[model samples]
Target: MPRFAANLSMLYNEHDFLDRFAAAARDGFKAVEYLFPYAWGAADIARRLADHGLQQVLFNAPPGNWDAGERGIACLPGREAEFRAGFSQALEYAQALGCPRIHVMAGLAPAGADRAMLQKTYESNLAWAADLAAKSGRDVLIEPINTRDIPGFFLNRQDDAHGVITRVGSTNLKVQMDLYHCQIVEGDVAMKIRKWLPTGQVGHIQIAGVPMRHEPDLGELNYAYLFDVIDEVSTQSGWTGWIGCEYRPSRAAQPGATSSGLGWLAQRLQ
Candidate 1:
């Protein structure tokens, strides 16, 4: 069975960021992931993970100036310094938290920007990240987020992710396959997983209901069937990676509710 991790950034919104660790453990999650952990000290985050006995499955490298609408800096021109610095900080957190993987987001391309140049910059940055992460025995992941959710985002397709991985040519570099983004950008997700998962390229997988980004049980995607497929892929490929539950709870709108929304995960484990 694939180990499932709660995406604390989206789930367990009823508690403070630091407190979400205990919430996830209380709800029976052995692993947890989040978007960014830069705000809190690494030592504090590490202590929480150790206390809760939760493995840090994944997290994103800092996206530059997120409040100002900058999604990431890896693909942007003239932001190499910012990208490297952000990655250094992320590496520190990953090391402190004992995280094995980090997702490097490709920032949005400028309007009418040179596509080839963007690809080049993206590949170069990924290579750099992969090299640095390899030194610490950690993997670097690149996710192909759909443009619908993140308009103008440079990396927006599986093929694009494949190209970047191929161009970078690093064993430490792998794909972060988020089913929500994949279903929105390119449907036929089961086929995509079967095709991609066995290649030893996928380092991690994330899931949320399509169209709403809610609990997987409410999605158009047949997650139960998809989980079976994931199992088969794991059996065949000997994959031991985590499947991150990166979804918003249906009760997110209802604050202070004592619900976990883990019905899908519970059924799967059964």
Candidate 2:
């Protein structure tokens, strides 16, 4: 079976931060991803995961202004210093936690920025990140956030992600395709998956219900069937990477900070 992972950053509320691992453990998932974990400390999370037999499929270095709608800093100009400092620490954190994947935050576009310049900036940033990852023997993923839900963020499309990585031309760097974002931006999920899977550009995958970004079963993303497709791909090519569940609980809107109910997702994974 293709292993599935939860997005602990959003699921943190559903199980309370402390027990998110246990909730994911119960839900039948052995791996997961999160937006950031600097506040939680590396050792603490690693210990918790060890206790629960869980692994971090991916985790991002702290992105600037997540609350103000900023997702990452990979494309932000004049922020190269920030990206370097932040990612350096993230490498240490990932190494300590034994996480193989780290998502580089490609922050929002600068005010009145030139497209070509922004593209160059992104390419340079990925090269820098890839070098660090290579030395550490870890993989790094760059993500594209959907503009519909996350307005003002740059790097919102799979093509953009692929272009940046291709320019950098490093195996240590690849695209982190968030399905929820793709469904919103491109609308064709499975075909895109196949298109990028062969190039090895699609490094990581995240799933959520459309229209609401909730559980995979809640929206019309067809995750059950999608997983079937993923299974087929895995069989033909032996591609067994993590699929992160990054969604919110609609009814409980309580930030899922303390629900302890997230483990059900693990159980739901086939």
Candidate 3:
């Protein structure tokens, strides 16, 4: 298997999220992810994992004003204070949860903001967090979420993530090239993965589909062919890591996601 992890946040309406996590482990998921784990104490979640022997793959740091469609806040001007306070909390949450990767979201920037200033702020804060995250042996990564799903959101392209990763200049900081978002923002998903794979700083990977942003196979992207490309990369030296099935389920309890993704992911790992 490719080392799959469940995104607990997306299953909000279906059942108790933590319980769902426990069930995932029982169903044989070795890894998992969460969008926001703030409401649940890390100790409790950690205990649940212990009860099942599951590893948490990654979790998104809290996005400010989530209901307001503010996807993130890392690059905003005059919001450094909020970012500092909020990010501190997020890091603490990650630490307690023993999560290795934190996905930094670049929320919407203020109106009429200076582009140069925003970029500077993004780079500085990322570098600063690199030091802080080092304390926990954790990675701080910026993700390029698609603007189609999150209208007016900042950091909507892989280029933006790539530029910031280059600027931060830290082994602990990198791009979260979401295959789903990349498919929308730009095609050639597997090819880009090959190109960026060498950086070793593309800390994490995620996927859904192109237009619908639903299940991975339900969209135009050919996951079967994509999986083969990834398998090739795995064999090459210096580029291999986890690729999350960060897509929403087409239906409740799709075992194929767990079973099927694992079947293909196992090849990629080899």
lDDT at 211 for candidate 1? 90
- Which scores better on lDDT, 1 or 3? 1
Candidate achieving higher TM-score, 1 or 3: 1
CA lDDT, candidate 2, residue 247: 79
Score candidate 2 by TM-score against the native. Answer: 0.91
Scored by Cα lDDT, where does model 1 land?
0.90
**Model 3 clashing residue pairs (backbone):** 1-265, 1-266, 2-265, 72-107, 73-107
Q: In candidate 2, residue 200 scores what lDDT? A: 66
lDDT of each: 0.90, 0.78, 0.73
Q: List ranges where model 3 is wrong by over 4 Å.
A: 11-13, 252-270
Root-mean-square deviation of every model = 1.1, 2.5, 3.0
TM-score, every prediction: 0.97, 0.91, 0.89
Cα deviation of 113, candidate 2, in Å: 1.3
lDDT of 3 at 121: 85
User: Of 1 and 2, which scores higher on lDDT?
Assistant: 1
Residue runs of model 2 more than 4 Å from their true location after superposition:
253-270
Tens-place lDDT per residue, model 3, 146-212, is: 6677776678777768877777778788787788888888888888878887767677777776676
Model 2, span 176-209: residue lDDT tens? 8888999898888888877777676777888888
User: In every candidate, how many clashes are there?
Assistant: 0, 21, 5
